[model samples]
Target: MAPHLGDWRGRYRGAAIAVVRPASTAEVAAVVRACAEAGVPMVPQGGNTSLCGAATPGPDALSVVISLSRLKRVRAIDAANNTITAEAGCVLQTLQEAAAQAGRLFPLSLAAEGSCQIGGNLSTNAGGVQVLRYGNARELTLGLEVVLASGEVWDGLRGLRKDNTGYDLKHLFIGAEGTLGIITAAVLKLFPLPRATATAWLAIASPAVAVRLLGDLQASFGSLLTACELISDLALGLVRKHLPGSSPTLSPSSWHLLIEVSGGDDAQAGQQALEAFLAEALENGTVNDAVLAQSNEQARRLWALRENIGEAQKIEGLSIKHDVSVPISRIAEFVERADRQLAQAFPDIRIVTFGHIGDGNLHYNQSKAEAGDNAAFIAAQSAVNRIVHDLVHQLGGSISAEHGIGQLKREELLRYKSPVEIEMMRAIKRTFDPQGLMNPGKLL
Candidate 1:
């Protein structure tokens, strides 16, 4: 077994026959081929930052972990084509900086960008803060180079904007979560870097008000409104308690919105536009108290408050987490209904809600107020999930938003997905991995 497998959360531990670090695509293929011949299952892992436990394998499972960290490299950059081809193990932040150095922007800015690898991002089809302007990892990817379960490398690394070729094979592996193939390298689309930026922190009366304000801001700023995140009072409290130097932005409120607008090099003009929009929003009762960031450092501090939510929650205690998404218009109703039902069932529960509201996704997590009884609260996860997921399904929302269905949500996927859809996914799995030796017992 592998001597050491770094567990990101220390929640799941796995042992493998061996950990193989392949320096190149050919070496990765050879390792897979050898495993295939030996009838051994294989788990392809990158930065090992998966929150869904997708990268963690069971101790009893006979498998080999293929670590792609050694394959880190920036293969090619095409400024004319506005694309960069990078190997699987390239850190997301490094790729972003590389794009910036080339006078372009790769706008997949996640909280874990510093440690997460591009391969894991593509495998999970990660969504980040900028998803409101730029789409998820799938949308940013123009092409991919994957090593299949059968040791076959499919090189569809074309940097074309419009490729109407027979079948778009790249899409199959982007969000496959390592079930179909191992993403070795990819060609990702890049955009012109924004020169000017404006950010605001607004206090809202409720989630409904936040949703209405979002619509107003979108109508006014249009494409310039890059991000609009919603945070609840409970969520902010955790940050204030756990995160150092974190203070409330405005009067304590039920909800807060972190809005940002960016475009060409005219910081003054951007700030004026944002100020004008916020002024009108306040007058129209769309927002209550708002603070516009005067400088980049202030803007970053405000963002730190939003980004440190998960970390703070982890420090607090064990909690039940739900990463869900619904239609933008239905977000207000979803939050209201979910909170009402959960409160009714578990009256003593303390709910902390926040996330990318512009993208209609929320991290609706709950923890016991008294830390000593966390075990009892965690033991009710299945029931809590049912209550939340059922409401999400009723609202035409997804049970899992950015976090893919790993072993954590496999049964939930079956419960939520249509039989026909599940059957089709199974068929695809059989087609690509007939022996089910690639990341077996995951995402099915």
Candidate 2:
């Protein structure tokens, strides 16, 4: 429990009877069955990298943590079907590399890809920057191999794209956060590897302008617009301050956009189209300033700025964080309203806002400029959450976006979810896990 009990944020610690390492599907089933017979609750753990304490056991000290790290394996790769079957413990980055090795692309990407596990990714339905083009972990997944709470192995790992045979059971497990069953393996969708990729850093005026630029890019480039990340000046300042040797990607502006476009199998294809668009965009006054990467090295540096925001925030101080999403058309409104509301309540509240704006998700977090005051500011988390989440609700947005409703958001979920929807979810939980043995005190 020393390693698995704590989440990536180090904000949660759990007490479990023991942590069990299961190497195979049979072993996982056996362990689950034993726990079932003993009437002991079981927590299915992956890489222990969840932001919401999903994999961490409760403080009861009565549950067993089933660590799936030992089950790392690429079970099979069907490039013809554009799918790959991987075990629960396979690291997300390893799966991405494996897909590239097979001349395909597995587009489930995030900063934690190197440490996060496939099962957990699917379980949480993680959405990264590429979700603008591809989709969330749930969309990339085709089928699943789950260990039911009864200890029965359900092998539904079929790579068929048009399986409307019945209810999409895989979805029940994906994004379920292990409340229903354990995701042992999955058949994940893949795409043709991009031959040419272009990356650019743009100085934007505001969130509204970013949205306009996004629409323009999508209109011209279509689905080739792979990623569009939004970073406020405050967020970028944090990156520059904490990440040594990191320089600004463009002239300092109120906001910066890290954009990328990818096209099919032409190593030299991306630069020209992006260059043309930027030329037109500049002439029309959609963007303030821009720097198109001349080389992959430059591109990586530009990307590092966006990827390192979370780390920079950690180096600064504790913060109240909210991963919320609104409709793409209303993203600017959400940001404007939320920022104004927060500022009115907490003067000089340093706000760090950035995310996959193309997909309508924002990592909106707040802290004080001073490290000591930030600690006290952190105590107003509930108050901060109420303001942010209330506005998100007003905008028809979700309180929890990419992150799952783990123990952290159970109360929030109950508060926001409609009574009928909550009842249906609870009924499903009862049907799937009547004993409440699987990941107790989570999600529901």
Candidate 3:
């Protein structure tokens, strides 16, 4: 008998001979060794929040899943060093709260923060709403402790801000999607907790204007611009319909921008700066309408709309989803070209587009308005992907953005990546896991 493999979205399912829960790093190493001896592939999973099916094992693969849920522990925290060392299974939200309790900030955030684990975040190199300011999970990480396929543990966890001894081996596994090795623990960077914050929701004319507004805000506010998120009208409609207590922000504009500014112990000054920025944006017609939050509750309400987009889409029904990114300067062109191409290809289709415009990543999704023919729409995924990904390639963009090339985009990766880069990746994989037992059939 084996444990049933369940996908996060229920779209793909698999089965494994056993699901082993290791409570410590040593235990994880032992499990890996046993699996290696048996010549069974191992799928290392944490939180199982991967959107790209990377955590789900295939039915044909003889595998044992190493679930790290029990390895949750905060090994150490040094506020002076501005770093926190924690096990692979620590939930991201818990780590953030722990850092906050110590008067520091762990700024890696996503919609699944409550359930997603740090190891999974590192494996995927997650980029969330705050990427515009704090960068991606890879940027936030300082070091990692990984369990290689041969059961050897690579202890590279150090909290130093400056280290240039030799080759940065930790970088090899940060976004490798567990193909090379299993991450056991990590030393993550922390930031100073901003004492004051201001949030605003602005209605913009189109993606072009949204890009312009992003430039304006970045030029004026600089590092104080903590987040600049983009949401489209169709995506917002899904939220208002499915999620309770959700309402329209600005009379249903075509596009919306959620902006935040934060600094040290000066709420009034932050608010003033936001007001001045918005005033100037309005005077120059950069924004059509704007609403600033006067209270924390109000700010939370504004964020709820942006956070609920994925949930709303799930409730609506099956969709062909894409997590793509282009240069900030080419976002408008990408969107316009993608829209026209998709519409012409599928006349009776709905495009629900939205994402972190400041980071040039968009969750461009498509499905039928009527729920009855979702299967047909989903079946057309290959054709649709060819069209969309071709455009992304022409624009010098990535087909997969925050989401890693799990089982879903493995072929696409080969199609887009150069032969030399692919060979280099294969070499690294061999150097780390020669047997190909660690998270087989992923990334490379």
Top candidate when judged by lDDT against the true structure: 2
Candidate 2, which segments miss by more than 4 Å at Cα? none
Candidate 3's C-alpha runs over 4 A off are 1-4, 246-249
Q: For model 2, where is the 10-residue window of minimal lDDT?
A: 244-253
lDDT of 3 by residue, 140-247 (tens): 999999998899899999987789999988888888988888999999999999999999999888999999988989899899899988888898889989997945
Compose the digit string of candidate 1's lDDT tens values, residues 228-312: 9999988988998998884545876789999999996899999998999889887987788899999999899899989889889
Q: State the displacement of the C-alpha of residue 71, model 3, in Å, after optimal TM-score superposition.
A: 1.1
> What's the count of clashing pairs in each model shown?
0, 0, 0
Q: Candidates' TM-scores?
A: 0.98, 0.98, 0.98
Kindly list the per-residue Cα lDDT of model 2 for residues 1-444, writing each as its tens digit.
Answer: 599888877778999999999999999999999999999999999988787889999888999999999989999999999999999999999999999999999998898888889999988999998999999999999899999999999999999989889798998998999999999999999999988999989988999999999998999899999999999999988888899674544666898899999986665667988988998887888877889998889888888888889889888877888999999999989888888999999988989999999999999999998877888888988899999998889889999999898988899898899999999999999999999999999999
CA RMSD of each candidate after superposition: 1.4, 1.1, 1.3
Candidate 1 has an lDDT of 0.89
Residue 175 in model 2: lDDT:
92
